[model samples]
Target chain A: MTTITKLPDPVAGGSKHPQRGKTPRPGRGRRLGDLRIALLFILPAMVGFVAFFLIPTIRGIYLSFTEYSVLGDPTWIGTKNYTAIFADELFWNAMAVTLQYVGLNIGFQTVIALGLALLMHRVAKSTLIRGALLLPFLVANVIVALLWFWMLDYQIGIVNEIINWFGLPRIAFFGSEQWAIPTIAGVNVWRHMGYTALLIFAGLQSIPSHVYEVASLDGASQTRTFWSITMPLLRPVLVLVLVVTVIGSFQVFDTVAVTTGGGPINASRVIQMYIYQKAFGESDFGYASALSVILFVILALVAFIQMKFLKGNESDLD
Target chain B: MKKTLGAVAAAAAIALSLSACGGSAPASSEAKGEINYWLWDANQLPAYQQCADDFTKANPDIKVKITQRGWDDYWTTLTNGFVAGTAPDVFTNHLSKYPEYAAKKQLLSLDDAVAKDGIKLDSYTKGLPELWVGQDGKRYGLPKDWDTVGLFYNKAMTDSAGLTAGQMANLDWNPKDGGSYELAIAHLTVDKNGKRGDEAGFDKNNVAVYGLGLAGGGSGQGQTEWSFLTATTGWTATDKNPWGTKFNYDDPRFQESIAWWAGLIDKGYMPKLETTVGASLADNFGAGKAAINTTGDWLIGQYQSYKGVETAFAPTPKGPEGKRASMFNGLADSIWAGTKNPAASVKWVEYLGSTACQDVVASKAVVFPAITTSADKAAEAFKAKGTDVSAFTTHVKDSTTFLFPIADKAAKVDGIMKPAMDAVLAGKKPASSLTEANSQVNALFK
Candidate 1:
């Protein structure tokens, strides 16, 4: 446990001074040296965080209450943008569509990733296999969307060609309102599932092998061992994965933008696409900022709930 | 902690100052300096490069740097540039966007310069120069080129369908019965069972070749899709164009025309709206999956470029007005208000709008220059390439062309109309649904 706590602190090793008295409080000189070095090391990252993340987040929040058209100075509009968004049918439709996509993407991704991770843990632990599984995640989102777009085309795409060969009607994967969201979700799942599986695989590796061996010795069936021991031990990792993936799925944009452009008639207009259309397409940056602020609040609340309800910080092994 | 705070503050100060320096405007306006120019069309880049070279030769003090980006990225980057004050000295402007930019004072008014230089606005094609004049009576840009829509058909498919060149050229349309245009489309469309759309036992469900390729939902403007049809029915998009405060999308004549256009999908004369997404209509026509495509003259080169497919152009069919109609859209060059080399920028724009540059552009046969003589030269160039572009030019000759609708909140208008139009095209809702969308668009103006 001590080693585990110290594992992430590489600076701790160099900070140890035999000349200093063995006390909880280090000598002033040594402390100063450590502080300076630590400050120097983290300064670049701190500057980036402040400049890109913190400042923009604050500015975005401020701009949400204004009417900025990206051409002229932003004007104070108070909560008008928010009020309009609340009453906007398109905004509600976008939210519903985004939720549907998130549900489909995360649900399939989590189950498939968990299955792949288990298969890797029990059967094929080769680095080659892991790398092969992760290839799709390495490709750009736009490229993946375009590739699948052609492959799933209604008339001449290879997938539809196969469907035709099988004497089934070709599916309008990206074109139909009913299939657009599911198709986008499916494409993203294919791209992300491999990376997700590897994350779960890492969590699996961290589980002490002795626990599994002891369960076996107790004459525990594989199913019972998985349900009682493995499941609980994997809960924290699963929670983290869910929080990350759910947040990611909510912001689904590139695939839909490249493929559907929020069509077959608002059938696949996710929140991000709607925000993008407002900001860039309509030059309504204030409305777009407000939309993003809401998204941020929702994500924050979701993460907090996930951490609290799932007890994601606590581990069964601990 | 104090030392750390001081160091962090210093670092942040350095970063902020660096960014400030990066955003600083160039030295004061000069008639002789390097001027950055930007345009969206890659095809016109080389032609413009030649123009730039010639301009540099004539005025060695002024060097031009040209950049080109695809359509979507061009507008996005230009908008960001406007905010950052790093926009090019000159850029290609569209009618839909310039109105907004002019309203916001992002565009430099070219009226004084035009008057000072004695540049004749009458040299440009009729209605071309007036498009650049803002609501405030300021000329924001100088017209460069113009485009109009026509029917591009697969010649082999049309010939096999027993359609003659004369028959294809003289086709007429009406919203009530769909006229000879619909008949041509039906005769050309073939099913998997090798039956024409007009033939008995024709399978609309399994169309092997759509008679008319669906370009898109045509959001608001319907420029190439149904604008010609709607115009022929005397159904305008707005109460007045340019700065029109009201939209007329709910007009029964317009709705009926759109309904007739959408009905083609059900009849298998056109592909489903869903099928057109992410698929190029020109490619569909080239692949023999579509027999005919109604598109702008700008795509003439692209449609002609498909190897092994013999393509030909025909004038848009005559409508109820007893004349064919097309949306006459033109592109122009405008100077950015934030430019440091405003004089040089205006000079470059003037040269671009002049016959000197336009002739070079026309010689390439890529597009029709705004100048009447330059446009004629372009037609000859097309003839030299063995492609007759009279189908597109005829609308201009017959004065049946309508101005491309220009208005404020154009993007918002498109946003409201795209889905509404898409729903109608997808057969999920009737054309009457547009009446609801029309009110929402009108509300934006209010």
Candidate 2:
């Protein structure tokens, strides 16, 4: 039988594996054939990292400090772009809208997703329902956004027709400044609902149903049983879904663009849209990169706090 | 079951791909390496294709490969190509965007090309060559076409309001007391309660239609719309104003113009601000939703689909300055400085400037020739479609116009202008507060 030999990366630090094979001394040539084979396996990935990811990433960070127009040589005006970005009211406004969007949809996507997941677990015996429920999630997000745009058009939209049928005033889903962000959030929720539900459904299925039956036998009601049994068990999956959804919400762009064009005045403008505008519409890449760096820091910080507060480790699963 | 689900997910991911990539089916094996040409107007490409065919007949070695995209996408792709180093050999240029590209040194200077081709400056409109000149006084493009802001009013709407075409044709604005055009606009304005704006004691809140439509807020900066307000109010966009970097949109006259524009929205004479930011003011007019749309002469054929709609052209309403003032704007054929063959590129530009090509381009549609002589063909093209474009020539003498500035800092100004106008349109900021935008833009320019 063949065994794989691998060395821990210096960046990753100390290996956890039981050392049956002798480790090579630092900077010394490899003595073992397995070590050479391991290197051969890892070489492609390391080359790819250097060629594609690391080089461009470093360059992008360097470019962030300059006011580049993409067409010409980027002139370094160190921190000027960053200073301008902070002073920009639209940048702040876009950040606020993005926060609102993330805050609004984070709870919504999770709640709706978990609710559907619970419902799916209850009805797990039905094959057709399980398959059909996920169609919206299966559909492409860009297509979903486009479909919703047409469905929400002012003059001839289906959403209006449906509301009119109910004797309620037709809502201007995409156009109105007040409703634009909410509309985008709602569509985002609708698009992701099925996939998130599927994730929680898998998580739910992993939990033995005997515990639920035990609770029922102990005279536990559905609500009481869910809070006591399901809530504790789904913590790990919930944390994962929440983290991903929050990140996704912060980066939201295409839908807002397809529907509103940041219109009725910057009401639906988001950070990514601002980045896109500066980078393309105005050809101000340096400022856009500054925005990007800000966004990256926000995402990283948020993710860190989420990891700390939510306790995503295995010990918290109990 | 999990394995099957994984397969389905994988299939879905595969389906998620399929970006509309790949060039057209490879052309017939020909000697002249295919030159990539980007264009926006799908309606106008057949003539380009015809021109390409004619050009190919003369130079069999050159195959003009054309890629048509929307204006928004065209700019997006061209800008992306600048970074990727895969930009097309040739593409259309606009006054608003040329400065940035030229400043970046992305555009090739046509100075040598123009001289070599013996292309005389006298053939173009006075000061027209300045449109393609970068901030450093480098000429990067040759003038392609000229367009001046004017008014396109629905004759049917005016006739129904009991106004004659002759009166509307010469309609001018005096921004001082809301000129004669505003008076007529008031007369034509209709409310939800069917009250006319000109009627004594007419209600403004329940307005069903606005008589005059000048694109406002973010879109007011649109060439025709903003030019109408600024030129009439005596704000100079060119010649005297070297600070293309900062707009005086915050000045008293400009603010008053903005207030007047916003008043149309506030009074319910026009659509709500949210309703028309990036939305088509053109489509609004064509649907009989609005009566008077302030657009350029080029929009003459754009509204032809509106059945039986008799549209007439008029100069912008005169402002406090009087004299029905306006600004002239135009487009140019720019060469990218980073191009592999600057010589080959100018030959292409010179060909575009040639009367034969301009005639071909003009004969096809309502596009006015940048060349003075071939403009009649464009006018004739419009006349064939049963619309006279003679009004375009008449206003050139009186209008104080310039192309949209291409200051190296154009991107910075736009960044400031978009949000500032957004604030004004949303009513969060006063129109006069645009001085903040002006200062921010000025900072970038310096």
Candidate 3:
């Protein structure tokens, strides 16, 4: 895996240039040959990225400034779509609802995952338990949503049945406006918690064991150790997790789509659901594209802020 | 860097070319090749496959390839196909969707084909053929099957409530008070403590069986849910039938009917609107959670399939209009504008609408075919299966059915109305809030 290159500064690095041209030429040629082979290996993925992701993103941005209804050629309308979106009450509601869902989902998911990861670090590290925890994440979003949907049904669901057994009133989990978004957030949190836990666990594993040993020797209590050692060290992993999960939760669609379809009255109409409804349901692709571009900007900004403010790349473990 | 860029560029070019291949042009009409057919109903796939088999037997030159997707996927895929110019040569069309397709010129007008083929418009049920005519007066499709809504009741639940079959059939409803229909629903509902909804000690919250099952808010159309009730109040959805610009959702008659319908939730005679989300109304009825559910004739087989549940149909209760009203929705087969074999596609669609294929479809008893004789045969087929579907047929017989509203901006209209109606049904907003929604809907046409 090593590469050798001829040094241009022979006088300054004379010792390093002893075997310059003769040996390094072949090495450099081999490196170039290896680069070609590497590019060939990655060609398929590169093509896919360009065609599906890169091209569509460009097309989507272009379409955001036009009126495209899928049936006909797009007609440019400039900032009309964006202007309409700004004035749209539903758009604002969707933003608020999506933010609420992201807050609840990421908040609960990260807290629970951190606890689970810490538990795995301390007590049990069985593969079976990790596999079991990761099972819900493996299930399709729609399937997970439906499973929880039936489980949380107002009348007949098992959750309500248990609630009734305690003499508590049945909750209209997906039915009522107040409970819909939180219910959807809870469903997604359940689905994603284990995967996030495993991610944090991997970060936990990477932290030098000697660091924790030194902390224990220094008579740091479990609480002090977690706050000072574990929390600070886990910052990078936690930031990445937050960035990923927050962006993901903000685009919540399938769970809300299957469960409430944005309502008892637009309660769970997350931003993505609104975009989908605009594009596919209402055939207002221009507005939908504009909404998506806004969402994309928001997500990018959120990630940037998370990375910068938390100093995500500069690991304390160093 | 240059070498890697060259490789990436070559790969991207190859990928673009490969993606471009997906939008292959339809086969030229000169070549009598295969005609791709698409439909949503899995239950009707066998029947349609039989027709395709028979169609190939007669035509031999044109092969029919059938694709069936679930309802939601079907429309989405078809819409995507239209954009890609890869849509099937012929596909099952819904009344809700065809107007939008026709407006975009994505559907081929069949007026010439219908005239050339001598397909009698009168041969189909009374309004089936007319429903397919676009606002431009060009036929976009030929009617394949028709459905009308009716009351599907749990027979055992009704009988135990001291409700006789005659009484069930004759129940009347008015928006002012729910009339005998509400009384029947109340009497049919039972609490866990064995108290009926009309009984002195009946617990609305703890009811063991709801009197009626809700089928969501029914959005703009309200086809099976409250359309019959609203129709009786003489409140049409639009100023005109097919291409009406102004919506009538703000009409007092419509608002009153909606208010009364939502009131059923408060009265605890019906399941809460929230309970129906992600739940099937037919399943709820079959499970005996509800004594009655007003649904379409298409679900006759579904209700009948529930083992040990005796299900019967009652005509939608007589509305204030002095007759029971049902929304008459008909499915049609339309030729895609971009079809390579227009002749063959038209031929297939013609055969589908003809008695030859319609009778075969009728025999399946899965749905009532559009052709008058075929629909009669379908009713007989249902009778042979030990299910009398007169409650559905009687609408057509009595001419008490109204067309499923057809108009432009149908999706946008539904978007506005769904939440508006959901709010009303959820009891968060009064039915008067629909006036704002109505204005929003009307604004779309402008």
Candidate 4:
């Protein structure tokens, strides 16, 4: 297609403007043609974005200020739904749970992923081990949750069996209030660590081998070389992983829904589950939308703060 | 790149337009009447398909297409369908959701259709016909089948414990003392060292098998969990039957019953809440890991199919009210208000609720039919299959039964109660948690 457009220009230059020995302005038709071609290139994406994302988001914001149950016509209720959510104790409780879940998930996933990446990078010969480690990441969230639900069962689970073998009492992983949230975070980390580790591994590989060679020449210890070279170079990828993970942890629903249904006393009922209950479970779409907007603001604020913090102070690498 | 983009865009536009126009409209005879019917239960699919075949044979012009979804997805998708204007011409409805749908005018009122078709509503079980009536006194659906909770015990285990049928059948219960039913559960619960739960030296932590299946921590309905016992204690879900605005979760009797139900965990007679998380109580019972299961009668066929398991059914134990009570709930076939073929759809619903079709369902014995005669036939068919379904039939015929709770904000009630109930069942708190939960439930109405 670019070839066709170029052909027209060459033809115009040779046949019509050759003797003038001057660079010609593109014809109005040719300029319009370029515009059409650009539009053609972008139209499909634009249509999808408008249809699925833009329209729904605008409508959701509109709904947050109105009273609607999906089945009936929405009534203009002003800011009533938003005010109600602010006053609702359950909403705040869900927010607190969601924050704790995000903290635990991000903290565990980052440490596990970076540690695994370091270990796997050292054993570079074992591609099969890397693939095997990634098997959990490939499994669907629901399947992972269901598998863990059984594995963590207090009586019949293999986990409890192993615990009993060591002359220790079995832990009620999902049933106990203190254990439920942390156990869920552990499961999320278990399922996601492989993917995050692989990302870090890619970043590690991108740090030129000569940099490590130079560090070895300097007689820097392994830990010292890592701190001076690898860590600084891995900053951007780390930020990317951290942001993606924080966003995802806030939206955790499938694992919680399947494993606990946010139970043993709402210990695992994160914000997404609460919003889901309000929207689909109770048919309170307006209130749900209000809660959703609040979540959106929270996530945006968190992401901004993270980006600011990550970019600030010109760390030794910068 | 430009031409490729144009081609891709054109294809996407075509696809979008095609999807916008997709999905066949509701069946009308003029456009080849092929009505879609939806239901949730996979076990009932074969029986319903057989009925659809029979309906098609009788009415050659209309074709019935049946689709099955799981229980949770069925309601979610159906509600979404109602919003999308793509709901099936006819679909199965539940008592819990029908009222809300009817209130929203999503269901086609079948009152005039029933009168015009001369359908006898009396043919269904006694309370079922009235159950389909909405708050406005309009009939929104036709009764299809009913179910009740019962005590399912492993016959071999009960017999080995020297528990006779008479003792099991005559057991009565109270909140203070657990009656003979508790004793039976204790006797059946054996530790890894061959001591019963009732024995002094029994190791509660090392019990090999629970005497009762408490799989899946707790249910909001209390259907199989504690509803039977609680109902027998004269506890009702709401102030009224069909559309009660107030719930009674904070009632003293109800709280006591839940406390006792949760106490079984301490006694080592029931599975811990954590152990129940992803386990199916029915599967546990079928595998002989649970000595008894208090659940709905719909699982009878599933248990009967287990090779080495010998199952027996008994009524829920009588309570302080001097009567055994169970939640009597039923399914109905409703017409979508958006349906184009109301006449044909009504015809299909009437047939589904008729004896001819119900008899097919009864013969399958997967579920008890709504029609009293069909229910009796189902019992005889089960007897022929070497299983008795009278445990459920008796609830309909003789036992004192309460209607399943229905309310405007039923889902809100659940959102409030389920976690609170889970707390009690998990032993984190007593049933007193319902005090705050009840306030939340009532707040929804306000």
Candidate 5:
């Protein structure tokens, strides 16, 4: 093993005096080797960031402050686009819808995904059950939305047929304002919960068998052991899943666009759909970029708050 | 293992950056040698492809490539292509889209091309050639096809209701009482208990079959829904066509017409807005659930499935203007300004607008050709198909059709009015809800 080394404090102004004790340092070659390996490993990610994310994000910010329709030279018009976005009623409505969508989606996805994961953990022939459950997530969002759209058709849908069999009035799953968002949330949960469950299942598997054995030896009941052990250890994974789910939920566009087309009086028009209309429908790229920037900020703030509120320290694992 | 992973990472970084740089520039070639043509409507694709084949056969030196994209994707892709300087040499253009494209100078002016080729502008449908002219008096495209709205009704329902042929043919309407038109529709609507809308004990809440359906959200252009009624009241979308800068959505005549139309929902004459969620009016009509549908002529074939449902067409009801009217809209072929093959591109556009190609287009009976002679041929062809297209053709022969509104801010106007109209149609709000939307539309011009 390489020995740890210490160097003289550079902040103290290195002195040649004998009273200034010699401090040991790590081997220079080894440190350089480590740095070189790290850079090599990180370079691909850095390139992808700069090319796809960083460059586009920077350009988008610049475009937001200009009057651009993507056909002509961008005219500088500082803050005009942002001001318009703030004053637009549709923007606020979209924001409200998006937040509602995110809350509902995360709520459904978390509870159902965790439950499924726990069930899978305790079941036999889990591989087959897990594979069958993940089938929905494997399908594309557009396909899922379309399939659900047909399945929920008021006149000819299987779902409505079932409702009719129950002697209940047929529900307009996609047309009614009250049901559109919830229907979208249900479809989103159906398409994503399986993936989330698989992730949580992986986290569950990482817990050592000894913990459960020790808890059993202590005469702890099944529920008590789960609350004391599984819940505590699963905190990090839950936080990660929550953050990811939040980000995904905010950027949802395809589901709403395909199923509702943001209709029934814009009841389900989320922020991304609003941005898309501005960008493509109105051909107002500058305003769309401004909206996109605002959305990015919203997502970042949400993720930051989630991290601060839910993340436990490393010592929590012990 | 670490070394291998590091090498792989470095290679990936280099490859990604190189790929990014590689795709920034599209390979552009001499345009005249090989021209790209694009269209959106899949139904019209095969006809245009035949035209392309014939054109290529005549001009051995030049080649043509045709691309078909769906409606929404087409516009988005074409706009992106214009920005990227890789737009096709010639493409199909809509009346709503060309104004903005022309204003931006992304479209090539065809004035010189028309004069050089001695193309007769008047040979096309009335008012169509003028529709392609930009606000600057420059022609940017040539009319390819035209369409008009008409009444599509289920014959079985009307027969059962004992509606006379004359009543259906000469139905007149007014914003005040809906005239004979409302009477016919009310006679046709039935409740779950088999009670007609005009009958006693008819439950409006439990309507089994609606008399009519105004499909699609009644956006600013209620083309087939309320335009005919509003037009008879002397209402127009804007002050002028081709380059109207203002929208007239706040006109009381228009508002009253919309109110009357939406009121049909409450009166149980029309389907509730929620009923048209995933299914189209054509589908509903074909399924024998709706008695009547006032939609574009293009949907006639779609509705005439011959599956125990007998379908027939009738001219749009005469409005208080003392004449029948429909919204006359057409599509055209336009050349990109950046096309290197201007000569060939204009040639293709002129050919598309010519009687020769249009006659071939008519034989397909997919759309009414822009040229009058070709349009007549289309009617004859439709007759051969055992379909009566005179409902749409009559407007053209009588010259009672109004131009579909075109303006600099057409898309903006649509975004503003669609939601407002949705509210009105849903009965959550009255037609007066369009006042704010109208003001916003007018503000776009200012």
Candidate 6:
């Protein structure tokens, strides 16, 4: 498994066309012999990725084109699945819900995570605080969802118990359609806030203390130091977080499945839940695949746009 | 290097083939070998093992090996095995799933097998055999047992309500406004805060125990909601498609059921949704917190282990609809079509369908025996526990149960129905909206 070369060969579409000297003539720089050896070195990983991730992804897209149930063979119905998805008000509703979820996750979660990261950097490096902060991330996602579900249960929930002690009317955490999404989003944020902070923390840690020291000596105020140095530097890490969190939000299934089950009437029904219910629950694999393709397209477009803007920010860093 | 690759690939191929061939039947001419059987219950393992023992003692050629798993895991593992074609020789099957599997030609149709062993559908209950038949009219399983819901009550709670066990044994409603039930519930109501449910001066909020216990946790066995309400409305759980096509949650009758159901929760007659959902349902009733809990026939053995609590059974209290209804479901033993020893598996089922084993199964009270004659054994066992279980048997016989159709889509519909039912019962949405959702679900079936 050793990477003998400093730079590995590009095996993007994979060993499907394994002509050793198959690189386009215009893009050739790393020689044929080097390419041959590099392909040999990367063959295991190249095969593994293609077999596991790439092929399935391609199949998923192809499936998005067709109608497939997980049990039986899928039939090619061309754009019918896609057409159904576009026409589905419920599916579109889920999409709007997902976009809202993504926006809140990226918009609110980013600022909060960055703020926490900044606070953590100011404090002395202590494992107690570091470990204590990362504890939420350590708990399994399903357990966290269940715990929050119990905490927020309307009638017998601890949340209502506390609220009732103060002689206030109980707010149903997931009871009402309005509160359910926010409550789910809140749980999602709590679970991932630690990971986001940790991501930005790593970015923060990489920026040498001398940069801050130099800024301080330049008479940079705490505000200036943060905006000028920290914020700019954290942009790369923040972009990574934003992209992942957005995608992760689209992939939110376990929480909704366990907590509300896409309910109070499909208010929290994200595309993933819909896709799953169609695919596994209903055995409408082709329809599910079509929904999945829509999900992929949405995710890809968002990622494209976000990263396009992010790449602009990143270039300013270099 | 080439030799090494070849050897590794060869070893892997050999290992796979070995596991693959492990599922095939041993040659009859050859010596005896062990066979694996999978069953779902943690408790019924012993009963099955005893059957295995009896089988092996008579026929020394096959040594039966049994691996126990819970229902959910068993289904997951069963699905995986079905895809892989390494499923067990004998396994438990349900009416919900058998039809779909049988339709796919996955299950070994026991028709020929039944004939070979001199077993007949008439040997068991009439309704039981119908459960194992798929959409194609193929008999995939032998009737294992059937389940019907019965109203179970606490003697202590009824005693406090000034009701006698004798009066309740043959209790009936006058079919007008459920005034008889309201009176019974009033007598059963005791106010911890000294406010009685029956008294004019009593406060509904201050009442302690409710007359009828409906549901505990969230998604119960569908007994509290579907049986009490949906049956009264004259609905069977099927859409145009086999999978759930209609979500009748928005039906006025259904909503009325929910509102009536909510009254139980509203009046402290039942535990809140979370408390009544799982193990705590049994525990809550066992502690005498509530008087009567609506449950299925399965809980009879389940409640037997409860400490300091002797349980009794009753029929579901008739509603204003004048229909005394019960939701009936049956479980059957299906043979795998791809089984190496289909003949032997059929032999095993013939044993299962026999009066001897059915009697044992009934005597254990694991489930309401699907066979009528053996079901008497279950009734006798329940009578020994001081609770008459004949209601389960008689209810199925007397009442016309709108049974689950073996549509290819039934299992899938159930998945959608459970959560939708949960939403309405939880009061997250008003009962009126259930019809809209139910219609939308019906559209899916269409």
Enumerate the candidates' DockQ scores in order: 0.41, 0.22, 0.43, 0.36, 0.39, 0.12
Candidate 4's residue-wise lDDT over B1-446, tens digit each? 12222322443443343344232222333523888999999999999999999999999988999999999789888876766566898999998888888877677788777877789888888999999889988898899999998899999988988998878887788899788888888999989998998899999878876888885534457877888999887778888888888888889998898898899998889988866666678888877788989989888888777888888998888888678888998999998877767667878988999999999999998988999899889889889988877677777778477898878877777777877887788788878888888888888788
Using lDDT as the yardstick, the better of models 3 and 6 is: 3
Off by over 4 Å in 4: A1-45, A120-122, A125-133, A154-156, A164-167, A208-218, A312-318, B1-32, B216-220
By DockQ, the best candidate is: 3
Ordered list by TM-score, greatest first: 1, 5, 3, 4, 2, 6
Q: Write the per-residue lDDT of candidate 1 for residues B339-441, one digit (tens) a residue.
A: 7677788889999999999999999999999999999999999999999999999999999999999898898999999999999999999999999999999
Q: Taking the tens digit of each residue's C-alpha lDDT, what string does model 6 give over A104-187?
A: 766777888888887788774787887788899999999999998888766557888999899886676775667778888889
lDDT: worst 10-residue window of model 2 chain B:
B18-27
Better of 4 and 6 by DockQ: 4
Pairs with backbone N, CA or C atoms under 3 Å apart (clashes), candidate 1: none
Residue A59 lDDT in model 3? 76
Better of 1 and 4 by lDDT: 1
CA lDDT, candidate 3, residue A302: 96
Q: Every model's Cα RMSD, please?
A: 5.8, 7.7, 5.2, 6.0, 6.0, 7.0
- lDDT tens string, model 5, B372-433? 89999999999999998888999988998999988887788888888899998998888897
Flag regions of model 2 displaced more than 4 Å.
Answer: A1-35, A73-84, A161-171, A315-318, B1-32, B200-206, B214-220, B237-246, B397-403
Superposed Cα deviation of residue A244, candidate 5 (Å): 1.0
Query: How many Å off is the CA of B26 in candidate 4?
Result: 13
**DockQ-derived CAPRI band for the predicted complex in model 4:** acceptable
Candidate 1: which docking quality band? acceptable
Q: lDDT, candidate 1, residue B383?
A: 100
**Structure candidate 3, residue pairs in collision:** none
